[model samples]
Target: MNQSRKLCQLCGLPLTEDQSFLSLLGIMSTDSNNLCEDCCNQLVLINDIFCPNCGRLQATPEMCFDCIRWQNKGYPLLEHRAIYQYNDVMKTYMQQYKFNGDFLLKDLFNHDLIRLIDSIDKDIVVPIPVSHYTMQTRGFNQVSGMLNGQTLSDILSVTASKKDHQSQFGRRERMNRQQPFALSVSSQLVVGQRILLVDDVYTTGNTMYHAANLLYQAGAKTVKSISLAR
Candidate 1:
């Protein structure tokens, strides 16, 4: 008689009292999954009070200020979501993801992503699109790479900007609040589908909004977002 062993979902190691619950959260995503319970619980966002769309911090259930502005003139995906807050750790991780090219972390990143997709009541998956310059310089789009070889990649595709839009992250982020994010969906892919855009972070949320609006304009039934952290 034998028993199967359990592994931590964050670092993917044999489970310990503190690390055993990482996989239980169902989004730790490491091959070995060695997350101690703290990260499993702490890293995950829960019971947040936010704008249903764009996942921005909202005072109440009603549309947040960003969404209101978008309605006047911005991307209008049916919904949007982000999983974490932008901070020092998140910044470091994202920088590492972009520059260092940590493809393996997709397991961790997309693990939460999968949870976001399944947990949040949404439709399709549209990972955020990076500009041409960033992609060329980085050698890859982290979002696209995350979805690659996964079930959702078939539905989502990258549509980069024409030139090197490599401006400051903050400035670019603010611009995305209402900036144009041109995306193309195939005929087969089109025709009234509910969509969920994915991204690494959710700061001003202009980028996700633009993307959502694009999908809505393209006849998507609904456009939503999934972020690892807000």
Candidate 2:
């Protein structure tokens, strides 16, 4: 019998244990598998209702007050959504990707992102960029790699930087990325196009707001944003 080779569910990249980037249990590194260990975690955490507006997991079967207020206020904050709450499970995996050099979680965590938004019609996928410091330390943009494209466009580019701002949350980790986010489409590339922005997380959304604002200034007519988890 000919066994079908396992390919990454997100990027369609072929996986082999011998040289796989990471390993999942019961999945031999020397054998073919669909995802590396980092990606496998995407499938494990489930069974919860996250607020559609803020994506916060709830304990009492009630809507998140923050999301409710956000909606009432006309969503000036953001059209935010996430698949999972930042529970211990989601938090551990995110830390692994952000600090430990596992870029694979982008696909694991955001597998449904583009699929859900494709119907809205976007010409480009702009990833939110990390500051020069974080980029130097992390070595890559997790946002850029998450939608690393099995089906999205082949071109992936980031074009601007905004001045970092103090964070509202008072959490240093949040402020570490305080640099203003920026995105530029060549005047020729986006005169009247609709675009969607992608990012790994959406906390205060200052980043998304700044990025969308830049894209809009560059001539985008409509902008929608998405993140893997908040």
Most TM-score-accurate candidate:
1
Cα error, residue 56 of model 2, in Å, equals 4.1
Off by over 4 Å in 2: 1-77, 104-106, 150-179
Superposed model 1: Cα runs more than 4 Å off: 1-46, 57-62, 74-77, 120-123, 153-166, 169-180, 184-188
List per-prediction Cα lDDT, in the order shown. 0.59, 0.55
Writing each residue's lDDT as its tens digit, candidate 2 over 100-204 gives 887755556344665555644677656666666667778987776666553442122333333332433464454335335443334556557676767776776
TM-score to native of every candidate shown: 0.69, 0.59
Clashing pairs in 2: 17-29, 164-179
Report how far off residue 69 is in candidate 1 (Å): 2.1
